[model samples]
Target: MKVLIIEDEKPAAKRLERLLLSYDDSIEVVAKLDSVKSVIDWFQTGKMLDLVFMDIQLADGLSFEVFDHVSITAPIIFTTAYDEYALKAFKVNSVAYLLKPVDDEDLSDAFAKLNTLKQAPETVNVTAVNSMDQIAAAMQMLTRQYKNRFVVKTGEHIRSIAVDEILFFFSREKATFCTLDQGKNYLLDYTLQQLIDMLDPTKFFQINRRFIISLRSVKDIISYSNSRLKIVLDHFSEQDVIVSRERVNEFKAWLDQ
Candidate 1:
């Protein structure tokens, strides 16, 4: 059987390919395409495959954009970390959804279903577009929502702290942390990477390796070397907050906005 892996991360793509190869020597990995541009280029050359393992969000844009530009007849299996698009993904009867870090059991199950369907009569499911629209709507719902914040404990029970009472976020030793204006700290469950993705970028900016400062908490900006800027944050001081040289433009744009 032939398969194609469409993923952005080189390591992730290689990992998936390795897992699939371990499943069966017969499954050929036709290609590993990374960004939207590469995928478009592949299709432009009239490339086709029996099955495709696609990621939802590509580096350039969404994978759904592929259908917008190309006419593909083969089936698709979406491998995503996000669960918001399940409704739309099931529209095509031959379609499947596999979450990331796909295991052998799941890959085996999908392959079993595909083999079964291949032997049966050919059929087309027309509710695909409607389901796709539903999936899109679900994604919109997940874009942003703020819940009432409170203090969470790792070991000891403690009184709750309001979200507004927090001053700055920091990452230490690969784990993210939250600090209140009063100098108390909490180890957060979310990684700084995931937090950056979810945090309202308009209100929170990753000023440096260690901090994501709130716009409301920034007191003033001080000039620093190499066109970087140092920021003074209200109720938060210990480490001098400086914007890295790489992020100087983004910091300026965030301030201007």
Candidate 2:
């Protein structure tokens, strides 16, 4: 099988290539690219590849840019350090992926699965426009106008809290408070729904109608009854933050990613 590796880090790219060779002596690595531009350039030359191992974040920007420039017939197994939401989201649109520091067993399993699917009568087809739209939607969902700071009024004084300092947001008796890492809460002018539209999806996940917890703030996640999940935050003390049953799978995928 001919494969291409697109990872920005030299060490990572080299290690992945070595692993690919180790997995199967007959497998050939066609190329190792570090940036979207280089990969796009390579694809434009009309060289064919059986599969591609791509990294989400590249040297220039998000690797999603490559889909905008090239039409790749080969299936891509994306690699990411974080951003599980995109992984799950893309999988629905026919993308395979592995997390960073690629594991030998996982890599082998991914190849095995691909090989198995290759034997099926039907083939997966992600045309240029389809791939572009899927990737664009995922990117748009994850990264759109996230607030870096919020202005809160305390008594007669007003202060700004950086989004990084926030642990979570909670609603109680018709009031919304922004809890910080230092265990302080400030009332905000917006609602949880509004916060959902404002915060970065990678940084904050809206567990339910009541709360949106930051990744840095999560202390633990416990499986609950009825296929639900209970989230514990570092300094959150307001209520039991639970992931609704309908959202359990997505919540787990986000947490694990």
Off by over 4 Å in 2: 121-130, 141-145, 181-184, 201-203, 214-243, 247-257
Give the lDDT of residue 212 in candidate 1: 85
Write candidate 1's Cα lDDT for 1-257 as tens digits. Answer: 78889999888899889888898878899999878778777878887677888887789876766765665566677777765223333435435677777888888887776666666545534224224454455444444475346557867676676667777788888887888877778987777666676665656788877888887778898999889898988866677889899998888877776
Candidate 1, poorest ten consecutive residues by summed lDDT:
121-130
- The best candidate by TM-score is 2
**Clashes, model 2:** 0
My TM-score estimates for the predictions, one after another, are 0.49, 0.78
Q: List, residue by residue over 1-257, the lDDT tens digit for candidate 2.
A: 89999999999999898898899988899988999899999999999888888888899988788878878878778877855554555665554678788989979888876776677626644322137667888677545567999999889999989999998898888999988888999999998998887887777888888888878888888988998988888886557788899888877777675
Clashes of each: 0, 0
RMSD of each: 17.0, 3.5
List clashing residue pairs in candidate 1.
none
The CA lDDT at 9 in model 2 is: 97
Question: Could you tell me which residue pairs clash in candidate 2?
Answer: none
